[model samples]
Target: MTLFELTNSLKRTITESSYGQSEKHKLLQSEYVSHRELVQFYQACNPTPTLLSLIRQTKLHLPKYKTYKQTKTKEFLKMMEKLRLEAQEAEYRKLINPDPEHTTLYDTSNQEYVSPVQAHKELKNQLTTIVNVFISVGSVSYAVWYWTASSWGLRDSYRVLLTVFFGLLVLVAEVVVYMGYLNKIEEARAKESKKKEVKKVIKTYDLTLDNLTAEKL
Candidate 1:
C-alpha cells in the first residue's frame, strides 16, 4: 500500500479498536513508554515522516528515543573529556622532556627551521669575521697608499689622518647597522615565544552518528 493509505488505515484501526483506546490513553498519560508498546499501539507503524508526526502530536516519549538522545549527549561529553586529558598530558610531557624540533623556529625567508639561539650566535660570528676582513684590507690599503704618497713627495699627514678617521667611522656605522639587525631578530624571537605560551590550541571532535547503525548489513 502507498504510505498515505497505510497511515489512514492505521489511524482508523486505532480509533475503532477497544484495546487501542486504552493503550492510547495510557501512552498519553505516561511520560515514557517502551518502543515495542508504541509500535504495537500504532499497529507496527514504520515510523516514516507521517508516523513520526503523529507520535510528536501525542507528546509521548519512547525509552529508546530518550536513550538515543542521552547516548549522543554522553558520547559528546566523553569525547570532550578525552580531548581535555590528552591536551593536559601533552603539555605535561612537553614540560618534562622538551622536543628539539619544537624549540626551533621556522624561518620563512630561509624556508627552514633554525634554533633562535644558534642563529644569533652564527650571525655574531659572521659579523666578527666580516669586520676583521674589512679592518685587515683597510689597514693594508692605507699603509700602501701612505708609502706611495711619501715616495712621490706628495705626503700630507693631515689628509692621511682624515682618511683613516673616515674609514674607521664607516666601519663603526656598518657594525652598528648589523647589530641593530641582530637585535631585531632577538626581539622577534622573544615576542614569538611569548605568543606560543599564550596561544590556545584548538581541537575538534565529531559528534554525529554518521557511521552508526542498528545492525550490521
Candidate 2:
C-alpha cells in the first residue's frame, strides 16, 4: 500500500476498533500511533519513503502520544482510587457530625472553585508543540556537532573512528531526549488527571433534599 494509505489504514483500523469504555480505547486514538509499528510496516514495502521524512510529513508522534495517554490513564485510575477513599471519609465524617453547619468541614462546597485541570488545560497543546520542536532541535544540533568537531584536528584514521564514536553518541543522546520528552508529556498528563481528581473529590457528591425527604416519608 502507498505510504499515506498505509498510515491512514493503520489509524482508521485502530481508532475504529470497539474497545468499549476501557482506558485502552482512549489510548488508541490516532495521535497515539506507534512509531515502531509504522516503521516495521513501511520497511516491508518494496519502495517506501524514509521513515523520518514520512514522519515529518505526517507529524504523527506515536511514542510521545502513547506515553501521554498511558500516563493519563494511570493517573485517572489512581485518582479514582483516592477520590473513592476521600468520598468514604467524607461520609464517615458526615455521620459523626450530622449537624448541617458542620457538613462544610468535609465537603467544602461553600466557595467558588476553579479546577486546576481546567485552568491549565490550555498549556497542553503548547507543551506538545515544544516537545515536537525538540525532535528537530536535537537532530540539527547533532548534525552540526558531528560535522564540525569530527572534522577538526584529528588524523584521517582517527577522524573516521571519532566520527563513528560521535555518531553513536549523538544517536544515543537523541534517543534519550525523545524518551525524556515522552516522560515529560506523561507527567503533564498525570498532573492534569490529579487536578481533575481533586475537583471530583471536593465537589463530587451532593445529597438532594428531596431524596432525603422521600426516604423519611
TM-score of each: 0.32, 0.24
Over 4 Å off, model 1: 1-98, 101-154, 197-217
79-190: candidate 2 lDDT, tens digit per residue: 9999999999988966754543434446554323457795587477557765765665566556655665666754656656655566566667766876798799778866
Most TM-score-accurate candidate: 1
lDDT of each: 0.60, 0.56
Model 1 per-residue lDDT at 55 = 55
**Candidate 1's residue-wise lDDT over 87-168, tens digit each?**
9997896686465554446524323357899789899889786978598658755865676577665557765665677677
Assess candidate 1 and give its TM-score to the true structure: 0.32
